[model samples]
Target: MAAAARLAVAGHRVTVYERTRTYGGAVGRLERDGFAFDTGPGLLHLPAVYRDLFVKTGKEPLERCVGLTQVDPASRHVFADGTAVSLPNASRAGIVSALDTALGGGAGERWGAFLNRARDAWDRSRRPLLEEPLPADVRPFARDPYPALRTGLLRRPAVTLADVGRRELRDPRLAALLESHALAYGFDPATAPAAAAVLPYMEQTFGSWYVSGGIRALADAVYERCRARKVEFVFGTAVTGVLVEDGRAVGVELDDRETVEADHVVAGAPLPALYREQVLEWESTDEWPRHQQAVRTGRVTVCLALRGAREAGAVHRTVVHSTDREDELDSLARGRLSERPTVVVLRPDDERLRPDGDHESVTVTATVAAGGAWASGNLWGAAGGPAVEAFADRMVEAAAAAVPGLRERLLWRVVRTPADTFRETGVFQVPGPALAGAGGSLLPAANPAPPGGLYFAGGWSHPGGGLAHAGMSGALVAGLIVEGAGFRGSQ
Candidate 1:
């Protein structure tokens, strides 16, 4: 929608073909018995990407379009050892103070020092990795940019996020705190690049935000913006193939065998292999943004509609770290269910989401493996049997640490697993923000595919997943389409 709006504003007639009846690919809401829950991301970060989009494409800005507010304490984290800390939103001093009070020692200072090094990385690769196009030669980005502290007898650098936390922070609890950020996005911190430090740095620096009605409201606003730009949306339609002629994409073939001819074709990564094969070719060499066979991760969401009102001082978001990180990760890699998985609990203090003052809505989420053994009926046997419910039980048990009297609240709960996700969307909707290490394996395909006039956008392409990165991809695709291949990103 962002790309379509921008293109429409530039006098290009735009049409969006949506396979589903509604828009907002993954950002959705579940409403049951007057209680509503955000099925996707509970919060927004680095909202400036959307702000920039609204400013460039329409008269009404993002703030005016959606009720955007910064969360006070960005998040509360509960570690395995029964330690809880609330990090204030975008306030470095407040975070340091809270961490020092909770963890004692110089944990706060150590974390601060780490953020300083992370800032160096954010400054160095902010453009090429995000604001600009992915170059054909990814060698520059393949090098990790994180300035990890020199350690060991030979002064070797930290290779991964896990190494960074253990070698630099030097505290198990603090290490868990650092790694939790990566785990939230379904990335294994042990193998994730140390350059992933930018994730926390971006959140803490820009602060976390919430849309009044849910994250879905942001999508609604974007869709409305696209509509206002005179962009036509063809819903309940699927493009079965892209028509590539003379080494250029000139149109798309619909599921009904009908073809819509166009001057350009913009594709998203989540589209089936048909669109992928037609848009870009697979090459092992220096051709950038090649398709990768990833062992993607998926999420399990449990929504609890309670009968009682929310507590007065309940935090909006809380993360309960896994008890056994290694075992949990091992199970995830092996495509087995983790007994005690890390769970994220969200209790939004919004009245509209509940039945009334006497009712509350809570959502618990956990990241699990996707499309391996899971595809072989391990996650849930066809119709969602006991295995899926048991996994939700584990998540609820973990979330109880955040929400007081969670079980006592006594309300019905709905469990949505990766099986449900695959059944509905036919994909896991996983992977996270693009990073600068791991041989550029984390980065998605670039905006402009090998076939001229064909572009890629959304979470699956350049800059990877998340709302901000997805919006950035749309902007990059728009820039490439409007200003031609030489176009750099937003100034």
Candidate 2:
């Protein structure tokens, strides 16, 4: 959306072709007969990133377009013994006090110390790593790595996420609570990079948030802003191929066989599809193997919408630990779902999603597996299939156990596995795009092409995933397009 807005503003005649029936690639809402569901990403953090985009587009202020409400005690962590720990985001001192009261003295201190390290890491990389583009050459990282390490950016660079957690926060329970956030990156924490610790720290520091009506509001706002800028949206259109002439992107060929010409093209879809399908013509001499082998992809997310008139009381997000924390690492590494799954229920403050007296809103989730269980049609509802119903029953059982009266709230439900997600969002293993690779962080390599009119955007590009970041990436792509869009006829 940002890229389109920028291109439109620069008078480049931008046309956005979204394969999905509606816009907002993976972070939009679905409304079906009075039931509203968040089809993709539920949590909204980093509001500033979005505000910046709105500002660039000269749209109404972000607050006016999207209601920004922060989630205090971002999520409630429930234990089998009925003990609950809620991590508050308002202030670290309050969080420390609560943890100290709930657990003990050192638990709070240990958490504080860990966050202090996170603060240091955030400061160091705030500009150099997170905000700036990383050089393509790995020498800086290969050399002294401490500049990145001392701040607790990413430890044990070559080791898996589990190794880092085991070494730092040894308590298995603490580790599970800490590592549980790894699903955000679509990897098991055990296998993910240790530096991933930053995710939780950031979330805890800057509470989770929601837009006023729904997250869909964010997408709608972007779309409206784009329209104001005269950006044309070719909805329900699929770009099947990139029309490359002389080894550069010139336009796109839709599935309908119509070619849309432009000075350059930017895609928000995955890169692998772009490359493997030859969307961008590759020079015979370019090194491309590392991109193919190392840029990994994430797994599926199953979303459920249940009919309910009652809320889950106080528990919003629950990570059920089947056993002591130590066992979680072993269990996850073995490719088994945790005995107690991590469930996040968004019973919002707004009364509308839930009829005034009834509770509503949806549960968006990510579940891991050993192999192809999710891929099997039996797990998701297929034609005349009982698998989806059975799976829904199991999820309801878990929810009922965690929150009283959850079963009685039964309504219509929809389940989306990774396979389903690929079909609905069209974000699966696309070519050319890879997850961020430089040091396991989202740092961009030098432009694959130098000083050309070409540009890139979307989660498939650098700073992959997340709706806000994806929007920001689009904005970045638009800026690049502005700089090189034949203004001076360099192309």
Candidate 3:
């Protein structure tokens, strides 16, 4: 939508072809027989990214689309020992104090020192790297992307997140908390890039927030802005191919074989899917062959949406760790889903987001199996059906144990496996591959695929995933197209 808005503002006749009926794609909300659930992402930390979109379109301010507030106690971590710590969203001193109280002797001071270092790294990298326009080539001398680390006074922490934390802070439990948060990004702190520690650092610096009605309102606002600018929207239509002629994307062909012609096309799907299915008759082009095989995808939650409206009490968030975390991950890597799963719950009452007066919708997610084991299931019978039902039961049991009296609150529940997700949104599923790709960092550059009038925006592109990065990718693709390199000519 950002891409469409930017193009429409520039007076280009823009049209978006969405494979799903909903507009937000992966960030969309799901409604099944009166129950509503945010299908994909729920965390809303960076509001400025979306705000920039509205500002660029000359639309109403973002606050009008959805009110925003930083969440108090950004996240609550419950341990197996009945110890729970709810870290205030932005209180550095407070968090350190709490950890010290919970863990004992010198831990608080150590946490404070570590956070201070993270703050320094965040300041050094925030503007000069993240918010800046990604240069076409970051491979020159003082400007070399590799050496920019030194130029910017940023030292590459030559250790994994787990390694760094252990080396600096000698507390195993504290290391677990820090590592667990990083794990949320689908990375194992043992091998995850040290920079990933910056995630919690930033969330604490700015805070964890939620938009007024819901996060999807941000997507809706973008859609409305595009519509006002006359950008055509074709939902529920899947693009089967990119019509490429003379190495330039001319338009697209739908699954129904209906072709829509345009001088420029921007795709927001996984790049691997685009390469595998789109770009018709492109054997003569370099864009679809070699570079197309570059990406490796990762997988996330097995989400469940409860039917009807009923408030999920006290437990705003819960994480259930399985006895076999490593083994489960290994199974997922081989395309097998785990029967025993870890769960994460973002209860409906987190921000009083439930329907009024003890009534609200709830969302439950279990980090179960992904890949082939999950992909082979029957999606329609998900709610009470064996596979999904068993997982939901385990999650419910775990959650109920954490927050007493949760089981009797009975309401309908629908479990969504990766197989179910692929059917719903067509997001390719890989068991345990890297979300950041094998390259480790999301440095910006021209499309690795054959360029020539073709471009992409979304989690599949550079600076991947999360709502902020995806929105920025859309804006970047729009800017690149408007500059006239004509995709194929960029390399």
On lDDT, the leading prediction is: 1
Tell how far residue 344 is off in model 1, in angstroms: 0.8
Q: How are the candidates ranked when ordered by TM-score, highest leading?
A: 1, 2, 3
- Compose the digit string of candidate 1's lDDT tens values, residues 89-157: 999899999999999969899999999999999999899889999988888888999998899999999
The candidate scoring highest on TM-score is: 1
Angstrom error of the Cα, residue 456, model 3: value is 0.9
TM-score of 1: 0.95
Write one digit per residue (lDDT tens) for candidate 2, span 1-491: 87788677777887889877888776656666555666666668778777887776785788888778877667766554556687776578877777777766667776666677656645544443333333456345322121122224553333444554555555555556666666555555655544555666777887788777678777888889889888888888888877777767778899899998888777666554455555555564254322222323333333444565544355445554433444444544554444444544555555545445554655635353423212333233254245444544555555554455665665656765545555654434212222232354433332233324455566655444566557556655665566643222110
State TM-scores per candidate.
0.95, 0.82, 0.80
lDDT of 3 by residue, 16-94 (tens): 8887777877766766544466766666767777778888888587777777777666777665455667677789888
lDDT of 1: 0.83
TM-score of 3: 0.80
- Stretches off by above 4 angstroms in model 3 are 120-129, 132-158, 279-315, 320-342, 350-356, 372-388, 430-449, 484-491
Go through the candidates in order and give the clash count of each: 0, 20, 10
Report lDDT (Cα) of residue 304, candidate 2.
41
